[model samples]
Target: MKSSIVIADDHPLMLKGMMNYLSSLGYNIVGSATDGSTAYNLIVKLKPKIAILDIRMPHKTGLEIAQDCKLNALDTKIILITFDKREDVYKKAKEHNIYGYILKEFAVEEIETCIENVICDRPYFSKELVPNLEKTYTNTDYTSLNKLTKTEIKILKQIANNKTSIEIADDLNVSPRTVDKHRSNIVNKLKLHGIHNGLFIWASQNKDIF
Candidate 1:
């Protein structure tokens, strides 16, 4: 029997393309959703064998939906798709224990391999994702960067994006103090303490990938 799967992405063209590709490969295309909320709702009803989720959806990110699925005790294997290629996102996905991680640029054959591996209970991470993740640790000043955690790096990205601590806290569902603590740690780690203007400049230069 073929494995049942659901594909969730905001873009219609990509969504249809993925569905057609997977169908051609002989996997059952159980359903498709254009946003994370609908995906979560459909998974609860459809109970597919696997879910292919796009990372950058509008309502809630693929990461957020994954967490919700896990909390609800859903058994569907998750295959994460992303174009961001950001180390922070990759680290978070690994921490979430996802079944497969696929970069958008990888060949369709690679995606098929990922699905097969994950269905067999093995985790699969595309080769590009691994190196991009390693690039995070190699470039930053390890001695000081060590003081900050992966979560902190995520928060740092939010700050660089011009999000206020309150905004970040609300979005991540954390307390304001937690956000502030992350900011403080990041500033100290980069040795940009008391240098508000330079913080953005430094982050812009580094682009958060070594």
Candidate 2:
């Protein structure tokens, strides 16, 4: 079956370019919208097989719309598009299990590949953006981890370095309670839940992200 798709973007030219490109690929273009709210409404009503969404939009962000679709139990697979290669955007996309992320300029050429990979139930990160993701990790400072504040990174590095909470507190000139709060914030910001799982393990393995 052809993948039923809804295209959402604020720019008229971009919307047209994407719609034209995808339609030529023989996919069914179910609908198009200029903003996230309209897109969400159309998605709920049309129940498309997949959605191609721009990250920035008026009324609501594409990420917010994706969350709503998930909350409403819509079956549409989402392919989030972005112009900027922002790390926080990627983190949010990962947290939401978004099917694919393609840079807008590359969409005309790379989108077909992204859709195919997503249809095969695989995660698709644009080749143009992988280097940015790697850069985020490699350039992380104990002062500025991606999407994390300076204090958060310091606490995370301390944890990764096998420091106890009290040790971290003393080292950072904060109280143990404050250190614990920072730890909790770090875990939540990184979407790490449960015991002995999530970024704690990932961070330990990639110590340089600390």
- The candidate scoring highest on TM-score is 2
TM-score of each: 0.62, 0.64
lDDT of each: 0.77, 0.77
Q: Which ten residues in a row have the lowest lDDT in candidate 1?
A: 193-202
Best by lDDT: 2
> Which portions of model 2 miss their true places by more than 4 Å?
134-210
lDDT of 2 by residue, 1-210 (tens): 478899999999999988987788799998999998999999989998889999999997889988887677788889999987887777777677687889987887889887886675545678887655645334434433477888887877766665667788899998999987887787776655652223433365467644
| Clash count in backbone of candidate 2 | 0
TM-score of 2: 0.64
Angstrom error of the Cα, residue 25, model 1: value is 1.3
Q: Write the per-residue lDDT of candidate 1 for residues 47-136, one digit (tens) a residue.
A: 998999998897878898888887888999888988877777876776565778888878365889888867765566787765545443
Residue 7 miss distance in model 2 (angstroms): 0.4
Candidate 2: global Cα-lDDT? 0.77
